[model samples]
Target: MAPAGSAACVFCRIVAGEAPAYRVHEDGAVVAFLDQRPLFPGHTLVVPRTHLETLTDLPEESVGPYFTAVRRLTGAVERAMEADGSLVAGNNRVSQSVPHLHTHVVPRRRKDGLRGFFWPRGHYADETEARRIAARIRAQL
Candidate 1:
């Protein structure tokens, strides 16, 4: 499990109340919030309270409830957005953007034009610049 001081992570900000989010569901164990940069209208993210870099790192017991929340969120997204299909995916490889674990529950339509999660990457000049961005966002959390 990652400690609260893991400053270089986005999910930590949401968990810490330092950042704002369109929170749809929350509990002692997990939080489901709308994705800021969404693939679809009702795209949401299900994240555990405890930070785990990858699915393999989280305790086996947590998988059930985590996915349970995902299913529930998907149902809500479907009704609210009237989506035809849905896609919930997690990454263990390069597809994973933030290292801290998060599952994206994307509400899909018939012609969303989204083939997969592909976004271009831009690098910062140095660690100082990255820290500045992280700190600024953390303060807003």
Candidate 2:
């Protein structure tokens, strides 16, 4: 994992594979992976290959490809999970987790029973449990 206090600056190390992650999708410009701590079942994150701190740091041309990936992944998640719809989001203010520019593609369903994810997060109880969850996501990836 990245060193501590990285929450403020950005999480480039995680993106670069300098740190461990259950990486799923990768290409020339973007890397997508399942969220280690997901809000929903098929939650995934898409970030640029370059190390930019925020959305404003991205070039004008970069937005199209990024969103294109997001759009494509939205379909992938929906088809894979058989969901009703999907949630595509970027970190403008409230949804920001890692400072590096990335988009979240969350598959949504009707009876899956989730209100929303605009709230606090609970900590995992132990490493064993976290590992199990990570393993499952890795399989899907």
Candidate 3:
């Protein structure tokens, strides 16, 4: 059965074989497939078999094995695409379009004309605010 709260999730449906995906690789814990809206031709998404909305939600025990699959897929993507390098990234809740935890492995080539980030960087309003944010994160840690 699909995990709780996973019925509406597209990735979960794909995992359940209720939807179609151009799957590239899959193991007990994770699956890798081509991105529907790809950054490049060979862009792929690696997702956990279980439905977890974000990295923070993933069980600590699952992290190493999950990333092992990611690492393997990264190497495979680079080799298969003949890319000079690859960009591997995961969005938390902020910019994540899908609720499921997944990593983007995009093949990159030199002079491909892709800029640094899709969004613009912003400066902290002031040093006080910056330190406050840092302190909050430090406290959580």
Candidate 4:
């Protein structure tokens, strides 16, 4: 059966050459394109050809190759935009604008006006609290 929501997924349309995109890179398994609403010029989104919905949905065997593509695109975005650095980020269902999974590689420069993560920062209440949180996550993995 087709992967869930592929019929309506924009990224799947882009992957199938059914939609127009400012494509920067493509391979058998991945596609990279400029974001229409770029945070900064040269911001690109990289996605797997398969319509996996989240990072956890990504097949373990595909993780290395998939991220390798993102890593390469990260460098290219920095060079092309003459940026001092880059932010490579992805969101799960919480902040995800689209249901399709994509990695955002945005060029960054010093004093770019963006502070950390566009949200307030916080610290663990104490070492005990931090350890409890870590242990909870470790149990899942």
Candidate 5:
């Protein structure tokens, strides 16, 4: 169900076809579209079809599927934009200008000059190494 105040939300209007968007993909639960003010070309935002004020507001059952769409779009964006990788991020409340739960999948290339957010990024040496890290998280979960 759409949250209260969705009618005033720009993203909600876009989802409802009341606003314009360069749509990339849409499913029963989510929509992917190009950001009008992209961090880089091919930067896309994946949002739930239902109105949600933030990630914390999204129903727990929808979390996995929402991120699944994000994961799929991340790969597509990278391939379509010829990017080396992608930077996937979401703001809960503080940096969330839209107030709707959305994920940013920004195409990235090495040494693209994006830096200094206090969080340093690194890569796993290979799939095996990455899997090990995943296992650690799974263990905790």
Candidate 6:
């Protein structure tokens, strides 16, 4: 695990509010926010507050709480986006854009065009749009 104060880690900076993020849910244990590059309109990333590099590095006692938050966020995301279902996934190391342990909760719909592992990212039209989506997700929580 990297130090919580690791200045080089972007996710750490986001958690510290040093970097900008549209955070939807935050608690003592975790933070859930809109993904800047979203797989879908309501894509979100749920991250632990601590700077654990990967899911394997997260403490055993933290696993349940960590996933519990992920589960709750998944439902909120799907409902907020009016999607049929969601994809809750985490990368231990491979394909992980940020080193910090975070889960991707992506809202899914039939014929939504997501295929296999090829993720086509999208962006919010503006900050206002991001904030609106974030607010909707927050409301569902």
Q: At residue 26, what lDDT does model 2 achieve?
A: 80
- Which scores better on lDDT, 1 or 4? 4
| lDDT of model 4 at position 111 | 97
* Each prediction's RMSD to truth: 12.4, 14.9, 2.5, 1.7, 6.3, 15.1
Model 2, residue 98: displacement in angstroms?
A: 1.3
Query: What is candidate 4's lDDT per residue for 1-141, written digit by digit as tens?
Result: 246436688888889888899999998768999999999999999999999889989999999989999999999999999999999999998988877789999999999987779778999999999999999999999
Q: Kindly report which residue stretches of model 1 are placed more than 4 angstroms away from their true locations once superposed.
A: 116-141
Candidate 4 deviant stretches above 4 angstroms: 1-5
Residue pairs in collision within model 3: none
Mark the 10 consecutive residues where model 6 has the least summed lDDT: 114-123
- Give a tens-digit lDDT track for model 2, residues 1-141: 233335344446666566666677887778888888887878988888776756878788988888788888889988988889988877764556765777888889887677666678798899999999999999997
lDDT of 5 at 65: 88
Error of 6 at 73 (Å): 0.3
Q: For each candidate, give its TM-score against the true structure.
A: 0.76, 0.69, 0.87, 0.95, 0.79, 0.80
List model 6 lDDT by residue over 31-138, tens digit each.
899999998998999998899888878899998889899989998999999999988888988899888989999999989898756667888999999999999999
User: lDDT for every model?
Assistant: 0.84, 0.77, 0.92, 0.90, 0.89, 0.90
TM-score of 2: 0.69
Clash count list over all predictions: 4, 0, 0, 0, 0, 0
Candidates by lDDT, descending order: 3, 4, 6, 5, 1, 2
Residue pairs that clash (backbone atoms under 3 angstroms), model 4: none
Q: Please tell me which model should have the higher lDDT, number 3 or number 6.
A: 3
Off by over 4 Å in 6: 117-141
